[model samples]
Target: MSTESSAATTLTTADLTLVRALQREPRATWTRVGAVVGTDATTAARRWERLHKAGLAWLTAYVTPPTWTVGYVDLACTPDRLLAVGEEVCRWPPVFSVERTTSDHQLFLGIAARCYHAMDTLVTKRLGVIPGVRSVRMAVATHIHREGGGWTVGPDQHEPSRTSLPLPQFWQDGSVRTIVDALGTDGRLSSAELARRCGVGESVVRRVLARLLRNGELAFRCDLAHVAAGWPVIAGYRLDVPADVLDRVAAAVAALPETRLSAAVVGRGNLVVSTWLRNPADTTGYEARLLRTAPGVRVLDRAVTLTMPKRMGRLLDQAGRAVGYQQILPAGGHPVPGG
Candidate 1:
C-alpha cells in the first residue's frame, strides 16, 4: 500500500468491520483483528495501513490526571474571521475540540487545565484577547458523565473489560510521558518503535505500557471522520435540570446511542450534550427521546454544528476526515498564554 495511493482510498464494508474491531481493542494484534473481522492477518495489516496513512481512521491516546478540570468556551468571532480564529485556537494545546456551530457564538471550544486558575488564565487572558473574538462565554464542567473516548460509530462488538484501575501515587514518571507523547499521534505504534523513540528497551516499553493502562493513567480511542462514517450532523444541546436530579439526568442522557459528549457544566443550563445524527431532522427525534428519558429537563439552547475544524487535537477537513495532528499535552504541560 503506497502512501500516494492510500490518500485516495474510499472506505468499504470491510474497512468498517476492521474499524469496529479496532474500536473495541485499539491495540489489538493484527491476527486478533483479522479473526474478529474475518480476514487474514496480512490483509488486515495492509488495510489498516491504508486507512491510517489517509487519515481516515486512526487511534490516539490521552492522559486524564485526577486533578484535571474540563471546560467549554464559546467564542463569538467577527463574522469574516470565524475560520481564521478557529484555525488559531484549534492549534492551541489546551483546546481539545473546536466547532463552528449555528449559534450566536460561532466557535465552540472544549478545553482542559490542571486547575481553575490555569483555566481562568487561558480563557480571560489568552482566548479573550484574540483579535476577532467579540465575546466569550465559558462554563466549567461540574461532572463529566462521558467523553468521546467511549463513543463508537459502528455496531457493538464484545466490549473490552473495564475494571477501575488503581491510581498510582507516582504516575508522573518520564517513561509514561514518553509513551503518551508517542501514542498521541499513533496509538498503535509497535512496542519496538516505542522503545526506539523512548530510548528504552522493548521490554521496558512493554512494561510501562502495561502499567499505564492498568493504572487508568492512559486511554486509547479509535476515531474516524463522523461524516465519512455516515453520521453527518453534530448537534449540541443545552438543558436545565433541577440541581437535585442533575446526575441522574446526565447519566441517562449520556447513555443515548447518538451521544458523543455529555457533561454537567456550571451554568444556568447545567447539562450539555453533543450528539452525532444522521441528518438535521433527527435532532427533533433525539430531543424528544431525551425529554422522555429525563422529563424534568428543559431545553435551554440548541445548535447544529456547521463544521468542526479540530477534534481532540486532530485537524479535520470540511468533510470531517482527519487531516493533521497536534499534540495535546496534559494540562500543566502546556504553557500558559499560548493555549
Candidate 2:
C-alpha cells in the first residue's frame, strides 16, 4: 500500500482487507489483522508502514466533539503577501488545520479549548493580531455530524437502502460489518459490490441493509460536503446573543444558501456560526446581517480561512499511531469506497 504517491502506487487486496479491518477496530493487533487477512504479524507491521508512507490509510484517535472548541476563520490577505500570511497564520498555537482554498481568502482554524473565552483569546489575542489578517469571521461548533464518507461507485453495488437505521454500535454484533465499512468511506456503494465486500450474497445483504436503514444505523441522503452544491462564501462568524435564541440563529444561518457545515460550538461568544458566503466581498455584511436577523446580537470575533490542512472530521493522530507526516488524504473517490 502506498500513501506517499497516489500515482505509480499500488495496493494489494490484502492491504484493502487490512484497511477495512482497522477502520472498525482501531486497536486490532497485527496478529489479529494477520489472521483475518492471512499474513504474518511482521508482514502486517511492515505493510502498515507501507500504507502509512504511501498515504493510502491511517489509524487515528478522534477528538470527541465535547472536549475541543472547533473554530473556523476566513482571512483575506494582501494578494502579494498571501504566502507570507498563510505561513504566519499556520504558526498560531491552536491551529491544527490550515489550507488555502480556491478563493483569495485562506482558511485557518483548529479544535481548541472548550471555554468560549479561549476562542476570543485566539481571535483577539492570537489570530486577529497576525500581520495582514485583514479581518476574520469566526464560528464555533455546537453539534457536528460528519457524514459517513466511504461509498463505492461501480457496476455491482448500488447504494444500499437501509430499511431501518441502527445505532453506531449496532454492527458490534457483525451482521453489517461490510455494509458499515463501505458506507464509512463512501456512502454511495452499490448493493452488489457491498455483498461482495461483506462476503455475503446480494439478496441477504439487501435484506439486512433495508433493516439497518429502517433502524437508523444508516442515514439516507446525507452529503456532509454541502459545498458540493457549489456556492462559495466560506462564511465564518462569532456572535454574542441571548442563549435562548442560540438554536434558532444557528438554524437560520444554516438555512441560508451554501451552508456546508454549521455548529453552535463552545467559544468566547455564545454562538459560532459557519457557512459559505458565495462572495468574500459580502463577508462583513453577512456577519452584520446575522446580528440583525437575531435580536440583541453583538459581534465578538471573526476571520476568514486561508487554508484547510484538514477538513470535515479527519484524525490527525495520537501518541503511538500519530506519525508526523502521515496523513490519509480523503479519497477523491477511489474504487473500494472510503473517505
Candidate 3:
C-alpha cells in the first residue's frame, strides 16, 4: 500500500509534480503528463501508483455549478448534528450538493430543479418539517462557471498564462472519447489509464489532453460533500410571486445569508429558499428577511427538504491502493512555504 499524504507524510519532488499536474488538469493522461515533466509514460504511471496508494492525491468528479435547474440553501447547527442532518439532506432530489462548511455558521446546499414550486416543496414541506432543521436560506443561479476548461494546473506553468485569453470552447465530441473514458475511472488518472481506455499509446493520450487543456474542454473535479462533516442547522423556504417578477426576485434570493445555492424550476411552488441556521430556534423573521429583499411583493411558498435524494461529488472509490512503482513524491504536490 502507498502512503497517505496528511499533515505527517513527507512529500518528494516527483510527488509534487504529479500533484501539480492534477491541480492543472485532473484528467490529463500519464503519457502526456510525463512529456511535460520529462519522463516516459511508464515512469509516470509507476510514480502515480505509489502516490495514489499513499493517498497523496485523489481524483473525483463534482457536479458542476452555475446551474439554472435548481435552488439552494444553508443550515447551521452543532457539530454533533452533522451526520444526522447530512443523512436527511441527502434524501431530496433537488438537493444536489450538501457541505458542512462556510464560516462554521451554515451548512451549504446545492439545489437543482426545472421550476420554482419543486424547490419550495424541498425547503418548506420536506426540509422545514425536519425536527432538527431551524431555517432555510434560498438563492438562484444567474451566472455560472461550470467545471469547464481553464482551471487545469499544468506543468511548471513555464508556459505562458492561458488565463489572459478566452478559453477555447468545444462541445464534447467523440474525439474526446479516450479522455472522457479515462476521467470516468479517475479524474486524477495518469496517462496510462487514458491510453488503456482509449486503446491508444500513452503519448497519444498525452497529446490529446494537451490540446484539450488549451481548449478548455475538460471538467475539473470537486468534492462538495466534505462540508457535511461539520454539524449544521438546515432549513428551506419560499417566496410568493408572479412569474413576471422572477428575474428580479430571484436575484434577491441569491444574496440571503447561509445560502449556498439556488435555482429556478417548474413545480417549485413560488420562490424557494434554503438557508443554514446555527440553531433551530433562531428562525426568527425568516419570511420578512428573505421575501422582503425580493424586488416584487410576492407570496413565498416553501418546504424544508426533510430527505435529500442525492448530493453532488462522490469520492473516488476505485482508486488503486496497492503500490507497484518506486516510492516518490507526487507532481504539483509540493507544499508552499509560509501558509
The TM-score measured for candidate 2 stands at 0.46
lDDT of each: 0.79, 0.49, 0.47
Q: Candidate 1: lDDT of 35?
A: 95
Q: What shift in Å separates residue 75 of candidate 2 from its native position after superposition?
A: 15
User: Which window of 10 residues has the lowest lDDT sum in candidate 3?
Assistant: 330-339
Worst 10 residues of 1 by lDDT: 157-166
Candidate 2 per-residue C-alpha lDDT over 1-339 given as tens digits, one digit per residue, 9 for 90 to 100: 222222234445676666555544344567887787688978977887676653445543222333345565656676776677766654443554555655445554543543677667767776677777787766566554221222211121112212222134444545465465555443335578778787878897778766664554444322221122122335555567688887777656554443434456555676655555445778777666666678787876565643333442232221111123212211121111112
Model 1 clash pairs?
none
- Against the true structure, candidate 1 reaches a TM-score of 0.91
Residue 1 of model 2 has an lDDT of 21
Q: What are the candidates' C-alpha RMSDs? A: 3.8, 13.9, 12.8
- Compose the digit string of candidate 1's lDDT tens values, residues 178-217: 7668888888899999989888889988888888777776
Model 3, 1-339: lDDT tens digits are 222323234446676666566556555677888887789979987887666565444454322332124345666565677668876765543454554543333566665553566556667777677666666665654432111122222222221112222222222344455355446335665578667776788887777666655554334541211112121344565455567876566555554544533344443344555554445554566556765765465544433333332334222111212111111111111110000
The best candidate in terms of lDDT:
1
